[model samples]
Target: MFIYASPSVERMYGATVDEVVERPIQDSMTPESFQKALQVFAEEMALEQTGAADPMRTRTIELEEYKKDGTAFWVESTLSFVRDARGKAVGVLGVSRDISKRKAAEAEKERLARINRQLQRSDSLARMAAAIAHHFNNQLQVVVGGLELAMNQVPENAKVFATLRKIREASRKASDISRTMLTYLGQISGARCAIDLCGVCKNSLPQLLASAPKTVSFETDFPQEGPVVLADGEMVRNMLANLVINAWEASGEGAGVIRIAVDTVEPAQIDSRHRFPVDWYPDDTRYGCMIVEDHGCGVIEADIEKLFEPFYTTKLMGRGMGLPALLGILRAYGGCITVGTALNQGSVFRVYLPVFQGKPSDTMPHPVSMMQQYPKNIGVLLIDDEDMVRDIAEMMLKRLGYEVIKARGGKEGIELFERHHQSIDVVISDLTMPGMNGWETLAGLRAVDPQVVVILSSGYDEAHVMEAGGPIDPPSAFLGKPYRLQDLSRCMQDVLGRFQKPSECPGDRLQNALQEMPDGAFHKNSAEGT
Candidate 1:
């Protein structure tokens, strides 16, 4: 079928309908009176579809059309598909008209609106920071001055040392305020596993409440059934510490109550939109939610929308990082967070985290020691790039009654191993380093003595690491960073116990190999000539 238009042709393209027969339609939409038409087209196209929509269905779009002289104007387009005798879509037809001046005016207005919002947010931050700085700075000054005075007055032998200790502790806490701000930005990275949430809470509450003003009372509602999250224990502990502590401060002095609820948040209650890019984790096990609530005055209505934006605050002043940091941590784990508050009531911050799927156990799985009793003279070579890690490991191993030798890098480690290949019981090395890595060092050690036992240690994710080529075999052992003192002690003793002087080949095997030599092999290959 064919279609046609008349007056729209002459006004839009400066040509009669005759010119449009073999010409483009974009050139036929420059008419001046189509401003109203553009609005209607925008409304229709706003119903954006996902994936492909059905054919023969109507679709509308907005575009700019050019006249013969290249003078262009905006247009509203209504499009419909043409079909074949077999009922398949063959082509599309469209009708459009001009709206150039309106488009120009709207572009200018949007530019101004965006600038206005940025200015307002910046202005709010400046005002908030000024109001809060004095109180924080004042507290810091007093803690520091008090410590100075105590240092002069308190005698070394006096029992009032306890009070001085408290003052020093308070100063250190004030120091941590800056560090905690970093935690709020989700900059902290560490390992996490399924651990007792209640236990971490109880152990951490004292720190949360310590700096809190006396007027605020803290309480918890943790169920015995256990609320668990798959996360680094210390990192989660730090996250809850920041949120709970912020709630205490928000309560303002001692007049408010902070309540923490730790229970499994039901899957049905969560709006899935909060977790964007939701395609990755289709299972509900991705996160566990924690709610931190306060019974102090609620937040202002106008401020709620911008609450989690970085550096936005309603208080006298703050790093404005608390909520933003919590959101960051959740996002890293493919999770979400939000806040709810009403003026004169209180605010509740909800945190959702991915679940940890670890070995099913009530208590942490403790690696059983392979060596129970042994003489203490065995020595081990410890190789790592970090001086602190190497020093501490060497000291710990030495204290466990074994002599410890230290190497700073892969080259040095190999040198020491080759020098004392027979004496060194086992080699411990960091996997990622300059010059060469753990795998290379292991190969160097094996070249000197194939029986050399090597263990790899690092902060890297175990699953993502590649052995590449070293030792010509899988690692004898691997330990993640921040491993326990006991675990290190046991690992050394166990690995050392497994090491033995290379034994002579079994008599039978040696004899069989000798018999299989070329001359003897000729005898076997020819049989007994019988």
Candidate 2:
């Protein structure tokens, strides 16, 4: 029993002094705290029974204490036994000081440390994903390129052609998976154009509904038009699918409804609730927002911070790449996501995208197209650390009617280019090589012949590679790995077309072309590397 409490107790615990005086101390403590206090008191009493307990010695304890208003706080208390005239222990004397501020500071420090650790883990996972995606995309390139070569050999009417086409499609999907892994690392490469958010969602809803279980139903609220954003349409579709699928799954095995809506939101309306890229904020005054609401098993508070982590999931057999990739996409677009949820109530995920201010071009150029024929005398220097990729690439070059010289790595490629600088009209070098990388190889080749045309190739997309600002002396062109005959041929045409003749060096011709073409017209080795 407290017997008495000072006026300070009311100030510390939000209770009046009279309300706490003469009351059982247990009433002011949590069940766990009360039990702990009882154990300590019993231990002290046992020591006192042996006459070994020092009456002047004070025992200190920190506990969570509550007051009349039910508000809890931390307090550090010191206790000593009060003695009679003959030194017999009577009552206990105790003094307590509120330590809520110190406790809160400690808690906040621990939380920041924990968040820093999570970021490090996420970074490590992202790097690992990049490495895996790099290698996987390399292999996929070979599969896709080889399949294209095989398909060309067989007539389209042949049964083998159909089989090859199916295999190629499957390989392309595999390539998408690798891209998703790269997306998680925020290294995805694709064209972005202004598109209506509501339209994209509506187009995706049919497929989403078809793929989802019958127990799940969808309710969509979309304005007829507008709320456009400058983003990759395919990636936006993938993001929508990811959110809707996650909502459906979270809705549980029983029947449930998921509501999806798109609206324009003012920047002021957005909050920082568990936003990814914690340092990011809305760059625009208005945002095109997509909200996904579900009446499923709402995310618990503990799991909210981890929802965007790659492969971290509460569900069994969850691959867990969806939300992470979505975050990556948002990060790339200078956007952010906010989450709201309560246990057993449901979750609402609001994805805010920066609104596009200008109108998109009426006609968008294709990313890849068939190449026109080039002179057979034109030569290419092909470099790669991978034997399979190099050999197949050489074959692809030859199939496009160009003389091919193969080099195992960047050093060898530079040597070959130096030896045959005049003969080699173009150099296609792999970006990730063991001894010397493509960037270093490009520099070396340019040192030998300033006009040398070098195509830097990588499993990563050209946009991602160029996003790092590229080399001081950039390559003439960028070739994404796993390219087919058409891709190789098209790149060759684009490179060679800059010059009037294949025999002459492109320096003078490039200068003339630059003079004639509009600003930003040059695609190869120019400021617009991508």
Candidate 3:
């Protein structure tokens, strides 16, 4: 069709005005755009014929238009129909400008907002998990401690002894579940030290292989001595175990080979797929990487983002804490994870831990012996908000041959310790209380006597308590809740052994006294001991 074309046609469509006028307008646009233009034109023509509105009224729309060389760009076009002197519709006129930059900016803003929302959700979930685990640990401590005491009182040949043992085992399993919840919240108790990924993975391989079915095998690629990261050794092994186990399960009924690898990876090489903890982003230049890849039925795209969510699993009988806890451990170590998968193809999980550049800390804790005995005249100030916990702990301390002074809260403990600072050799205080908490109590006790032995106890792990941040004065030692009699004994002995002179220590006194007293004297009840 012949029509007058503006000289600006060359600038917009990469064609001269004369050339554009010789061809249909569709040539300057993609087929989809041309079809859209036709629809708008038909609507305007119908309105003009019926006199439903002004014929020259303009309408604006954004569409993709093509240049003569076939490159496409977005344009906002204001279109109107030109009318003749008789008020009849004639030709159409349109003005369009590129809006690509504006579109990109809008998209970027939306993406940032979405990420902020995700971080908020992650924080909320972590808080809820921590609260649940903390309360559960507190109650489990009472049950576990009480069971151990009762079992000790009954003879091994008694009928009730076996039942009590079974109950204690069940309580221990429950304790493990509570620990997993804390791990998912990144509140696990473990020391972080510089460790090589290769050594950890290699050392744990035998156990991992034994746990998997014989049909599933491993293919490992590891560097000999490199790729060290600052993290907890046991937690690292746990993370690797979770990944390997998941890979094995994903391999399905057929025989499969799970590939495990460790090496140094540049930040730029990391694939953007599923990320753990939702809020983490890569910040390190180089990272120690562990890769676990499975060739069996891969994960679908829909389930990828949800893989690290607690209790979210595709399997029918899965508890779903393994991946979430793994993510928690990595998050605490200043690391991140990436996943790549395709349905029916395969899956690759890459764990990236920050490479340690400084000198590694080699200090390790000394194990306390379970047979440690307490002194005759020593006094312990036990502080806790729970009546049952206080009562059970008091009985245990008295049975262990230490005089007990019970305080219902931290404030009471501080006041009592001040009154009996010389008599109270050790202060065992619960970390979480109604007011003045364990940290405040520790500071208070230090004010009275700087050298006083204080053991901060919590249902949460020691690492979590330290991470919460308190006064400059740290406790002499930490004891996690739900501890057995042996755990309590070791904690007390360890702190006393480390801080006190050997002659003044209860353990030292017990060794000398054992020659005179009977074998069961230490295990007697508080009334019997008095």
Candidate 4:
């Protein structure tokens, strides 16, 4: 029972002293709070009745409390048991202070800390991904290059050619996966050129549509011209593909529609629609925007901010790298992405890329054919740590009618080049090696002959290699590993043909090259002997 009340009760519980005095304390509390306070009161009464030595005289607790108006707030209450001179409890004296604001602030602080930790973990994973990609690409080069050379030797009609082609195709798929990993690691490969946004969408549509289930239909609305962006065409396609696939999967197994549209967006419009940082865009600029919308179960509001976070997914089997990689590619080119979603309604993912100012140029390289006859007397020094790769490359050079010299490693290759620098017209050097790398070998060769026509080959893309601080002096030409015979032939012709004079005999063509190869052709040859 409340025997007395102070004026503070008016502000704390919306009751004046006169109204609260002599009223049961439970009358001022909610049913839950009343029950909890009664239990504690009963426990103290029992302690007093038993005359327990050093009994609890006071207690503090935090709980939800309500005012006369029924508004609830958290309160920290300290209750002191009043006792008579004989040590028998008579009444209670309590004091409480509102701590709601402090609790709310602490909760917000904890939420921010969780987000910070997640971002830190993401950064660590990105670094690990980069290291893995570098090493994986190195080993993949050997597998791909060796398979490519073996396929070249097999006749088109041979039984083994079909099997070898399938293996090479699988290897190429593995290469694609590695490239995706690099993208997630914040490594964007390929040159940036002015590319037509509409054209990329049109080209990617067939594949994207084919991947969707039959229950879903796709609609596209692209401007005929004028929305061009300076970006890698392949990366744009990949980003579109991922967005479309995500929409397709989200559309459920029932009949649905996936809509893709492209338009030009002003900086002001972007700022109004997205919560991106103020520095994300320039004050006056236009962006080429691609929007992919789907009629499906949309993401919840709470999860929207986390959609681009690495390895965060709502799906059971998802590895969660798709959206992160897409975002990484966009950010690499000073672009951004925004999304809109509603539960059970649908979702819209908008990708914005900075608009290119000038007229778009055709940056795609013309395909080169390797079926042409080779000019004779050209020499190539093949350097590789892997014996299989070295032997296969030697066979490829021999078939192309070039005099070949093999080196097991970069150090030996440099020595071999020094001894036969004049004779070696071209050096085909592997990028990753045990002792000395391709860059070092290139540097050593350039010291001996500045005009050294060296072709740098690697499993990794040229951009990724260069970004990782590869050779300062770029090679005459670059050959991506796992290249076909035609690619090798064209590269050699392009590099060697530039130096050869009109009077020089075209390299002697090897008649019946595959059929006439001796058994010793597969044997490893030391750099000293070559």
* Number of the predicted model whose lDDT against the real structure is largest: 3
TM-score of 4: 0.69
Higher-scoring candidate on TM-score, 2 or 3: 3
Each prediction's TM-score versus the true structure: 0.45, 0.81, 0.81, 0.69
Report the C-alpha lDDT of model 4 over 65-85, residue by residue, as the tens digit: 777677877778898877789
Model 4, which residues run further than 4 Å from truth? 1-139, 149-158, 202-211, 218-224, 265-286, 300-321, 339-345, 369-372, 434-436, 468-471, 499-530
Ranking by TM-score: 3, 2, 4, 1
Error of 3 at 89 (Å): 10
Q: Write the per-residue lDDT of candidate 1 for residues 4-72, one digit (tens) a residue.
A: 665677887776666656565433444543454446545434432332545556766677666666776
What is the number of residue pairs that collide in model 2? 1
Best by TM-score: 3
Q: What CA root-mean-square deviation does each model show from the true structure?
A: 19.3, 7.4, 5.9, 7.6
Task: Score each candidate by Cα lDDT.
Answer: 0.60, 0.78, 0.80, 0.75
User: Model 3, 1-530: lDDT tens per residue?
Assistant: 63776787788778788877787777766788889988987887777768779655898887777777888877789998777898777777777787868877877787677678767877899889878877888888889988988888899999999999999999999998988888877788388888877888999999998899999988999887767788888888889988998898899989999999998988887765457655677775699999999997888876886788888988965578899899888777778888888888888898999898865466376667766554575667889998888888877777666766778898888877776566567889998888887888888888899999999888786777887755556788888888998888888888766776555654444344435433432232357532
Backbone clashes, each candidate = 12, 1, 1, 5
In model 2, the worst 10-residue window by lDDT is 521-530
Error of 3 at 484 (Å): 0.8
Candidate 3's displacement at residue 486, Å, is 0.5
Q: What would you estimate as the lDDT of candidate 2? A: 0.78
What's the lDDT for residue 526 in model 2? 16
Q: Against the true structure, candidate 1 has what lDDT? A: 0.60
